[model samples]
Target chain A: MKLSRALGASVFAAILMTGGCDTVWHPSIPPVAGPAEFPTGQIARGAELAAIGDCSVCHTTEGSRPYASGRGVQTPFGVVYATNITPDPETGIGTWPESAFRRAMREGVDRDGRNLYPVFPYPHFTRATDRDIAALYAFLMTRPAVHADTPPNRLPFPLNQRFVLTGWDHLYLRPGAWQPDPAHDADWNRGAYLVEAVGHCGGCHTPRNVLGAETDGQALAGGEAENWYAPPLQAASPARQGWSVDSLTAYLRTGFDAGHGAAAGPMTAVTAELATVPAADVRAMAVYLTSMMPKPAPAPVVAHAGEDPVFAGACGGCHGPDAPMMRNGAPSLAMSTAVNAPTPRGTIQAILQGLPWREGQAAPYMPPFASVLTDAQIAELAAYLRSAYSDKPAWRDLPAEVARVRGAS
Target chain B: MIRLTVNGQQHEVDAEADTPLLYVLRDDLGLNGAKFGCGLGQCGACTVLVDGQPVFSCLTPVSVLAERQVRTIEGLGGNAVQRAFEDVQAAQCGYCIAGMVMRATALLEHNPHPHEDEIRAYMSGNLCRCGTHMRILEAVRQAAGQGVKP
Candidate 1:
C-alpha cells in the first residue's frame, strides 16, 4: 500500500513551532561485533513472527537476497525505498543492540535517530512485546549479512526532511506492548495481539486520513493497497458468506477459502508467507478477525443472467454454471467477495490481471486480459457480473475506472 | 438437448448441461480434432473457437455454446494456418497441435501479420509439452508470412 500523507503548510509550521526540532536527532550507536549465537528456539519463534509480519514482502526486492531491502514503495509524497535490515555492519542493522532494535520498532527511529517513514509500518510494530522484538533481533543477526546501500528516498524538499516524521509520530504513534483484555479468552487475546501488533492487517486494510493515519474508529473498514481495494473485515464487509474462523484460517493459510474467492494482488504474497508460520497462529488471527465480523445475513438471491458476450466467451469456460470448475466446487461468482465488493475496481482488476499461474502448484489460474480485451469490454463484463451476481447497485462510470486501473497496472 | 452450431452446420446433441464441449465432440458427434490433455484448461489441448475467440473446450460447457459459432480443427479442414502447421511440421506427439493450430488461427485472423513477440504473447495460453514450441512458433510465423486467408 502506498503512503499518501501530505501535511498542510499551517500544520507543518505549527508542529515545527511546537517542538519538531526537539527530538529530531538521535545519538548514533557505535558499531559492535555481531552476536556470536542466539538460542535456536528464540530464532525459530522469531521466524514465525516475521512471517506473520510479512517483513520480506515490502523489504526485499524481487529476485534479490531477502532482507537486503531495495524495494521502493510508492507513496503520495514520493517513493520510499525500504532500508537494508540484514546484519551487515555498515549497510544494515548489524551493530544495532537489542535496545536499538527495540527503539526503532517502538518509536520508528533509527539508532542515529532519524525518523523512519511510516511506510515501514513501525506504527503497528510499536505494539509488539519486548520478547518478540528480542527474538526478531536474534533471528535477524543470525542471517547471512549482505552489504547493500538503501537508495535515497525520492521525496520533495519539505517532505524529504526526516524531522517531519517526528511530528507525524507525535500525532499518531501509540507505543506499548499489547495487554490482554480480561473479558476475552486466551485465543481472543492471542489473536488480538497478533492482529493489532505484528500481523498489522490494519496497515493496508484500514482507511487513512489525509495525514495518512488510520481513521479514528474505522479499523479494518476497507482500504486501498497497491491499486487494488483491500476488502473490509468489519461490518462493512461485502462478503456474501460471512467469514467464520475456519474459513478465515483456511484463507489466511492457503490464500483461498471455498466460500470466498482466492486472494489476489498484495494479499497473495501475504497468504504465501502466512502458510509458512504455525497453523495455530494463523487460526488465532482468524479467531480475532472473525470476532469483529457480523454473522452472514442471508442475502436475497439475485438472479439476472443478462447476456454479455464478452463474459460468456471469456469467463464462461470456467465460471459458467455448467463449467467443470463450478461443478467441482470452485466458488461461484455470486459468492466472490470481489464481485460483491462495493467498488468495481477489484472485479475490474481481477479481470485485467487474472490469477497468475503458479508453477507446479495446483492453484486457480486465469490468463491476463490487459492486452487481449479492450477497456470497454472489461468494463461491460464487470457491469454484467455485478448485476448477475450481486444485489448491489450498478457501478457508475465503470469504463473510466477500468481505464484508470488498466493504466495504473 | 443442446443446440450447437459447429462450423457451418447446426446440430442438436443430447447431453447434460454441464457436459464439456470436448466430450460432446469426441463421444457423441465423433469429431476427434480437439484432444483432452489436461481437462483443467492449463494445457489448452481442447481449444476451439467460440464466436471467433479461442477457448478451452475441455472446460467450456456445451450449455454456454448455444447460438455461438464453434470452430474446431475438423472445421478448419485445409485452412492456411493448418496448412502452415503441416508445412512447418509443428507436431511432435500431435496431441497439442490441434489446440495450437486453433489459437494460431485466431491470432492470425485478428492480426494477420503479428510480430514474433506478439505471436508468443497471444499463444501463451496454449501449452506444447513435447518441447515443440520453436516449431509451433515457426508455424505461426510462417503462416503470418503467407498471410492466413481466414
Candidate 2:
C-alpha cells in the first residue's frame, strides 16, 4: 500500500494541478476556546474506530507519545508527515471543534479551511457516519495532550501547494456516509463500512489509476506497499489455500494462521492494531473479505530438491523438510502467498527484511538477510524457492527485481 | 557424507544435507563451542563464521558449506578477541560468551574499528542473558585497538 499510496498521491497532484477548476474555500471555524466535553460511551466507541483505522501506526513514531504525529508517511510525490492529532493546545488539534473534524473527514479540509492532502486518506474516511466522526473527535480530544510540531511535507513545486488538493478532491472525493446494502445482511454491511471507511483496506489493497485515485471496479485486486506487494484479497488472490471466515479472522487478529505465514512488512503493524479491536468486528471483516474470493483450486506442490546453497543454509533452519519449524507443523513454502504472488517483490522483500523478533512474544521469527546475503544471492535463492516449492513459472528478471528492492532498502 | 573445513581441518561428517552445522559441530564432530540456543536463529548462540561472515550455525546446513571455511570459537583459541574477552573478564555464567565473541570477531574482521552504534547493531543478534554487555563492549573495543589477524 505504501508505493501505491504514494503513486496515488502523485496522481492526485497531477489532477489537482491540471484540472484548473475553481479554488473552493470555506470560512474557518474560530478556534474552540476550551476543551469540549464528550460522553464516556462515545469516547469508548471512538477508541474502537481508531484502532480499526490504525490511526496510531501512521500518526505515532516508535517510542514516542501516541498521536503526537511526526511520522513521515512516504508518497510518490514526497514525504507527508502525519499531523499531531493529540489535544495539545499548542501543536495538536486542541482548538478544533467537532464540526471542523467532521469537515476534515468529509471534505478533506483543515480547521483553517486549507485543503488537506489525500495522503491522509480522507477519500476513505469520507464514507464514515457522522456518529463515528463525532466519536473519533471525542477520542482524539481526550488524549493526553502532547505538544509536538510536525515537520513540513517534502513535495516539489506544484504538488507542495495545498490549494491544488481542492481540484483533486473535486475529481475523486465522493462525499456522504455509506448506506447499507439492501441485499447483504447487517453483518456484511457492518463489515463493508469498517473495511471501506475506518479500515480503509483499499487505500493499500486497491490498485490506483494514473491520477492516483483507486480504480472504481477493482477494489481489492492487489497493490504495492513500500516495496513489498500487497497480494490481492479478491478473486485474484494468490493464496494457494482458500480463505475461510474463521481463518481470515485468526490471521487478522493474531497475524498468523497455520496455513499461511505471519504478516510481514507494513501489514505487520496493521495486524498488530487489528489485534486490539473486538474479535467479532474482525470476524465481520473476514466475512465480507472472504465473500469476494472464489473457492481456491488445490495448489500444485512440486518436489524439486533445492540446490541453492543460500536456501539450504539460511532458510532450511525454518523451512526445510526436517527443520523443527516444519516438523512442528509450520506450513510449507508451497502455501506461502508471496511465493505464489505474480511478482517477485514480496518474496525478495521477506528475505531482505525478515520477520522481526518481538520481545517476550513467541511468533515466527526470521533474521534479516539484508546484511547476510548479497543482492545476487537473494535473487538466486528466491528463484530456487519458487521452483522447488510451487509449480508456478520461474519469475522473470529476478536479478533486476532483487537489485531494485535492495536499492530501495 | 558432507565434507567441509572446520578450524583449518577438513572433515567428512555423516549427516543429512539439511542438518544444521551446529548439530554436526556439537553432536558429530564434538566441537561444542557453538551452543544450540533457540535453534530458530533468533539467538546467535550458535553463531559461527562461514567464509568469514557470521551466521547462525543452527540455521546453516552442511549442504551449503560444501567447500566453505567454517570457523568456531574452538578455532580462535587465545586469539586477540579471545585475549581481550579474557582480559576484560567478559563472561557471566558464560553460556552466551562464545557466540558473542564469534559475532564480535566477525564484525572486527569486516570493519576493524566500528562506531559504538555500529557495534551495538552488529552485536544485536547475539543475546547475552547474563547482562555482561558493558564488559563485552569493552572487550570488543580492546580487541579492535590491539588488531587481530583476519
Candidate 3:
C-alpha cells in the first residue's frame, strides 16, 4: 500500500484544503488560533506518551521521515493507509486544531466529523489523561512537517462503508475520562489503567465476538493481532513456566528475555516503544499482568542436548554446547517462542529466513536455509528442535509445512 | 500413577510430576489425535476435552487430570462433527483437524443449537494454519444441521 509520491501529495493537499476548515461544526471545543503555546515539560512528557501509544510505528513509512505517514497498515479486513500527522499546513495535521486532535483521539471522530476506523486504536487512546493528551499534541505539533500522501483504504463492500463504523462505534467506542480507582495502589491502578485504557493490550490479546467487539467473558484469552497471534495474558498461560514480573518487565523494556526469548515481528516495535518510556511504568504494567497469574511456577525443565541428530549436525556449532550466551542475539530453543509456537510457522520461518540485521544493531547473522537445506531436512530439524527444547507435542505434516512455507516465501 | 479414562478405556500412566497430558497421552497410551503444535498452549492443535471442556493438552499437567474425563478426537469416532468434517473434507493438511473437531464437538454439545455467530465466537480459539477455516465453519454449520452458509 505504499503510495506514489505524486498521488500522496495531491490527496494530502485535498485533505488540508477541504472539509475541516468549517469552524461552525465543532463549536463546543473552540479551535485555537495562531501559534499554539505549550510548556517545555509538556512537550517532553508528550514525547514519552507518543512512544507509549506506539504512534510512530503505525504512522511512519519505512525510510520515511517520522510522522510523515503514508504507511499502509494491513488488517484482516483491508489495508489502512496512515495519513500524515506532521504539522504541514497543506498535507499534514498542522491545520488540525487541538480540539480536532482531541476529538479524533477521544471520540474516534476526525475534525471533519469523519469516523476513524477502530484500526487507529482510539478506543485505547481515549483513556489518556487530558494533560498527557496535551503533551502528545505539543510533541507532534513541534515535529518537522513532511509533504506526503497516503493511499486510500481498500476495504471490500460494507467494511469500506465508513458509515458502517458508526454502528461499530456505538457498540464498542466510548469517549473516556480519567477516573481514579480509590481502592488499588497507585502502581496497580496505573498498570490497570494503562493495560485497559492506554496500552490497550486487550485490543489484540482479547478474543472478539462475531461483531468484532471483544468477548467480555474472555478478557485476554488470546486473539490475532495483525497476522501474528497475541497469546493469552491471564493466569495458567504459557508464561506460567517462563514469565515473572521481573522477566516480563524486562521483556517489555528490552526486546529480549532469557527465559521467554526475544520479541519478534510486530511485538519488536512495541517493545522498542516501551523501552522509551519510564522504567517504573513498564514495571507497573508487568506487575498488573503478573497479578493475573495464579502463582509462580518454576520454569520448564527442557533438555538442551542430544535431542536431534539433524540439529546436532547443522545447528550445534553456534547454538551448540559451546555457543556464547548471546551469539548474534540468536535465542536458545529452550526459551525461544519460535520452537514453542503451536504452529510450525514461526519455527519454519526462523529456519528458512535465518536472522536479519536489526535497524541499529550490528549483530550476529545466520544464513538463510532456502537454498542451503532441503524441505525434508528443514522439517526434520524443526521437529527435532521443538521436541528437544520444548515438552510440547511435535507438529505434524512437517514436510508439507516446509514445502508450503518455502513456496510462499 | 494417573488414572485417565480416554476414549472410553481406562489407563494408568506412570510419569513424573507436572508432565504435560500430551506426553502421557501420546508417548504412553498411544492416542495421537491431538498433534503438538505449540507446547506453550498458544495453539489449539493439542486440544482435548477434559470433562467436556476443551483444554490444551500440551500445557495441562497430568496432575490436573486425576479426576477429569479426557476425550480426544479418536474418542469421538463417528460423531456428527467428525462425520460432517469427513463429508466436507474440512481438513487440508489434516494436522489441526483433531483439535478443531474436538473443540467443535464441545461447542455443539454445549449449545446443541448455535447461531453462526455463536459457533464462530466459540471456535475462534482454534486455528487452522492450512486456511481451511471457511470449510471448517461450513462443516460445523452442516454438523449442526444449520445448512451450509450461503
Candidate 4:
C-alpha cells in the first residue's frame, strides 16, 4: 500500500512538471480558424502580400536558410530571436491554426493564452485586413518546413516574464484591421495603408520614448538606431538629393538617392526588400511621404542695434560693427555658407568645432568656445546670428540641439 | 582548408567551408574595403572580381573559391576604377564605392562601353543608397570615352 501511494505521488508530480514545461516551452498560441475560408488565389495573393510585408527581413538569418528564424533582434531590454515561421511540426508554425496566427499577428497574443511581447511588431500588423491576414496564413502554411529550433530570448528578469506585456498592450495596442477613410481617393488610401500597416516603416524611422513606443504626434520625424540617424520623412527634410517623386522612386528602388544619402544600417534591409516591390506602390509611398510637411510658421525677427551692450560686449571683438566680410578664408558672417545653409545644423557644427585656419590664411579665426559657453550663451549667439542675417526662429531648446549634434558627431 | 589566389597571389586559409569569401577577405586577410552590408547576398556591397566577373563576396563561400583567382576592389586594373571614382566624385560616405568600383570595373572589362540600360541592368544588384547613381553612371560613361555630353 505504501509503495503504491509513493508511485502515485511521483506520477502526479511528473504530470505537473510536464504541464509547466509545455506552458513555457511552446512559443506559439493555439490555432484558431479565420472568419471565412480562403481560396487558392487568396493564398497566392497572400504570398505576394507577405513579400510586401517584408516578412523575411526580421525572421530569416542573415546568411542561413531563409525564414528559418534565429536572427537576434536587439531591444532596449534584451535580445529576442525571431521564431521559425516554416511549417516544421516541432519548431515552426505547422500546428498553429489560422485564428491563433491572426490573434498573434493582430492582437500580439500567443498560443497557450500568453501575451506576446510587442517586439514582434503586431501593433503595426494589427492594421492588416482579415483577408490579407488569412492570405498570409495560407502562404506561411505552404512554405517548406525547416526544423530549426531557435533559442529562448534572453531578457532581463522581470521583463523576461511575459505577463508585463499585458499592461504594455493595454496602454499602447489597439487591435483592429485598418478602416479606410471614405473621404480619400483609393490611391491615397492605399498608400496610407501600405505605409502605416504592412510596411511598418515607422517602427525604425520614427522617434520613440524611453519605453520604446513611438511618439505618435511626431510620426516619422526621425529617430536614432544602431548609431545612425533615420532622417525625418517630412517636407522639412534636408534631402541631400533633391526630393522629386521620380528621384524618390529610383532611390527607393535602388537604395541610392542620387544626390542624397544612402540607406545604411536597418534601412539597408528595408531597401533590399522594399525596392523589389511594385513601382506604383513605391511611387505612392513617395507621394504620401512628401505630402507630410509641418506647416511653416512666420519668422520672428528680434532687432538688435549695433550698439546693443549685450551684442557689443560678447560679439564685437570678432564680428565688428558691420559683420566683417568672410575674408582670407575666415568665413565672414556676411558671406559664410556655414551661416547661410538652410538648416542650422552645419552652422552649429562649425560653432562647436571652430573654424580651422587654412595654410597662409587669416589668424583671427572663430575660436572653439563650446567648453566655455553655457547652453544659454550658445543659444543667444545662434539667435543673434540668425536674426542679424537669416530671418529664422531660434531652435527652442539648445541642450537638445547640443545633444543631437554630439550624438551625430 | 581552402586554397585561393587573390589578385594573382596564392593563399591558404582554414575556416568553415560555408564561410563567405567576404569574411575570409576581411577576417583572414584583413581586406576591409568589401563591406558587410545585407549578408544574404542581396546588396552587392560585398562585390569582388571572381575570375574577372563581379560576384557577391558574401554569398561566395571560401570553399567554392578553391584554386580560383579572386580580385578585390583593391587590385582592379591599376586602380583605374578608383581614378574614375575620383574624377566623377563618385563617392559620398564611400562605403559603397569599393563595391561599386568592383562592379563597374567588371563591366568595363567585359563591355568597354555599356549603354545606360545595360549599365542599370548590370549594376542593379549593387545598391548605392546615397543617390550618387547619376554621377557614378556619368563616371562609368566617361571611362568608356562616352564623355559627359549625356
Quick one: best lDDT, which candidate? 2
Q: What interface Cα RMSD is found for model 2?
A: 3.2
- In candidate 4, which residue ranges exceed 4 Å CA deviation? A1-40, A240-242, A294-409, B1-150
lDDT tens string, model 1, B86-110?
A: 9989999999999999999989988
What overall lDDT goes with each candidate model? 0.83, 0.85, 0.73, 0.66
Question: Candidate 4's residue-wise lDDT over A1-409, tens digit each?
Answer: 3443443344345445444334333355554332234578877777667766788877897554677899877776678888898767778877778888888888777666677777788889999988878889888887778899987998765566675555456556777778887887776677778778887777776788655677868777776554344666775454423366666666677655523433444555566676556788877777667667433233223344344333343344345434342221222353332343354555555555444322242222333434323444555666667667544455556566766765555
Off by over 4 Å in 2: A1-21, A24-26, A296-309, B1-35, B48-54, B61-90, B101-124, B131-150
- What pairs collide in candidate 1? none
Range of the 10 consecutive residues with the lowest summed lDDT in candidate 3 chain A: A19-28
Candidates ranked, most accurate by lDDT first: 2, 1, 3, 4
TM-score ranking, high to low: 2, 1, 3, 4
Local distance difference test, candidate 2: 0.85
lDDT of 4 at A382: 65
Provide candidate 3's TM-score on chain A: 0.82
Better candidate number, 1 or 3, judged by lDDT: 1
Comparison by TM-score, 2 against 3, better one: 2
| DockQ computed for model 4 against the true two-chain complex using alpha carbons | 0.02
User: Model 1 in CAPRI terms: which quality?
Assistant: incorrect
Clashes of 2: 5
Candidate 3 Cα outliers beyond 4 Å, as residue runs: A1-34, A178-183, A208-213, A304-309, A326-331, A362-378, A396-409, B1-150
Candidate 4, CAPRI quality class derived from DockQ: incorrect
> Which ranges of candidate 1 are over 4 A from the true structure?
A1-11, A297-300, B1-41, B44-126, B131-150
